[model samples]
Target: MKLNTVENLVRPVFPFTAIIGQEEMKLALILNVIDPSIGGVMIMGDRGTGKSTTIRAIADLLPEIEVVADDPFNSHPYNTDLMSEEVKESFNSQITLSQKKIKVPMVDLPLGATEDRLCGTIDIEKALKNGIKTFEPGLLAKANRGILYVDEVNLLDDHLVDLLLDAAASGWNTVEREGISIRHPARFVLVGSGNPEEGELRPQLLDRFGMHAEIRTVKDPDLRVKIVEERSAFDQNPLDYVESYRSTQDNLKERILAAQNILSDVHIDYDLKIKISEVCSQLDVDGLRGDIVTNRAAKALAAYKNEDSVTIEHIETVITLCLRHRLRKDPLESMNSGDKVDKVFQKVFQ
Candidate 1:
């Protein structure tokens, strides 16, 4: 289908605010939106828990970004390296910049996606026809300055997982194919969802996510009913359902933008930093990732709530999300990661 036709046929997404329950999943996604530098979020949960719904809603609600027009990677106007050589030449020839609202690209990495599809490939058509070694941007390029979402992430091939990890960590995609080398900024928020019953995620891959949130089916009858009703309404008339929640969605978008505006000014005092370290030390988290992620998540929460500084409350709210997957797993222990985090959190903060 034509792009516009496909987009037109696509039903409007259910608004973010309309999602019921799963507060941790919501918070983790919001935090990542507020600060992509917070790494990314890993959501492990049961099927039909709105994991995919919430992700699409988030993409729909994100504010638009400006880019150099016709740039395959959605390269920032000022970021020369991300632009094609033609765009660079146009810059010297007085290229006109344009702006348009876009639903932040949320590219899904499928289980069977090939390396070339993910990292892009050499333009064989151009090479064979015109003897030009042009490059074709791939999923990684398309995901630049947006979100890379992987469902059933634990089941992903090891090589693909490693590729994702490298992109997430380095914020760049460099593809050298058939002697044609290309590089571009591939900064994106990596979000993944999977069911643990399928299999455990690799520790290295698990550690890459800055925050981890586990969700379960809604147990409360009232909330479950509400969720069911909402889904039914959405399925009946997606456009009307989205319209009904537009105001709430706008409020959320405004709040996210406001938080981002004030995030740099939000402060974390030395004592709290020490406390964060103490908590990490007690938890036996490897390296300094947990501490750094914890600090970032705490500050992001404070910023999201329009606070000027990080506090114990902020730390408490974000500790579990940041440290959950970082803990060493024990085959003999059955305690939930959240419970372990809460225990350490209370002990350290108190």
Candidate 2:
């Protein structure tokens, strides 16, 4: 089966393993896959920094999910709550489950997408032609248990941003139209990338992301040349380049799956938890989100490292990602938000 549903013309993506630099962005994406409740990732950076490419490449590495056959929402057969009332009734009489080795869906939410298209719509054709009320699943449905990637996310309309934030928070999408209402599971890892120069995301929407990563061009001449060389080789022969990195990608995938399996069992240290809370308070972060996301991110990092318990090191690894986007901008401070996070981290954890 295809990894992700092909909603548009397809293109060969740069291999995730082959991409050089931007390790933080990659880690944030992987952690979300391991435990999606960590919230989605927001990658803010300059153009040509592989932000979009990294999001696309992740689709190739994710494992397939077991879902109900032909389910529009990719609903798991065993999760009755995720199913619609009609579907549950039908399942009472008969139940069928299928394993689809699909690409972890990486759905693009275009700037032009309307509410009707992003959220499911009433089936006008069925209503007019057959006198039946039906629901036409939309992009959110396709993104269930997957990634909803928005390029230039800062440029998205305020209303659309609000809609996405609501769905991200509630893990459900309910569409009401003409006396017909449809509800379905819309849980997804919301991956958004944008050049900060284009615009700033709404503060409310920005806070919804679980982790934030900043990407920039490689500065070192040697690394820059290597990045160019790798790109040239991939362009010269996409298939061959992908094959060369296949083993590394497979290994990483295995690690991610293992991490997911043990994520719940990974213990959070009480002292570390206190440190996390104290750090958030010191940073003057808006709400408890920083503490919550920091805890979750550290747990994910521990899981990624196959550690049974979270450590100050694990918390340090993720504190920046969890709090960078939530910090209030200080005009008098010369340091950027990320830099501020680093300074605070040094003081709090040192």
How high is each candidate's TM-score? 0.93, 0.92
For 1-350, candidate 2 gives per-residue lDDT tens digits of: 55665643355678888889899999999888888899999999888888888888887678777676777888766667666555676677685555355566779999899998999888867777898878888999999888899888898888998888789879999998666677888889999889989988988789999999988888999999999999999899876888899899899999999999999899997877887888888889998999999899889999999998998888878889999999987779888887788888889888
Candidate 2: pairs in clash = 3-102, 3-103
lDDT of 1 at 171: 88
Tens digits of lDDT, candidate 1, 1-350: 45667777887888999998899999999999999889999999999999999998898899988777667888777667556556667776886766455668889998899999999988867887898878878899999989999999999998998898899888888887566677778889999999989997889789989999999998899988988898999999988888899899999999999999999999999999999999889989899999999999999999999999998999999999999899998988899888998998898888
- Write down the RMSD of candidate 2 (Cα, Å): 3.3
lDDT for model 2, please. Answer: 0.86
TM-score for candidate 1: 0.93
On the 0 to 100 scale, the lDDT of residue 2 in model 1 is 52
> How high a TM-score does candidate 2 get?
0.92
- By TM-score, the best candidate is 1
How many residue pairs collide in each prediction?
Answer: 0, 2
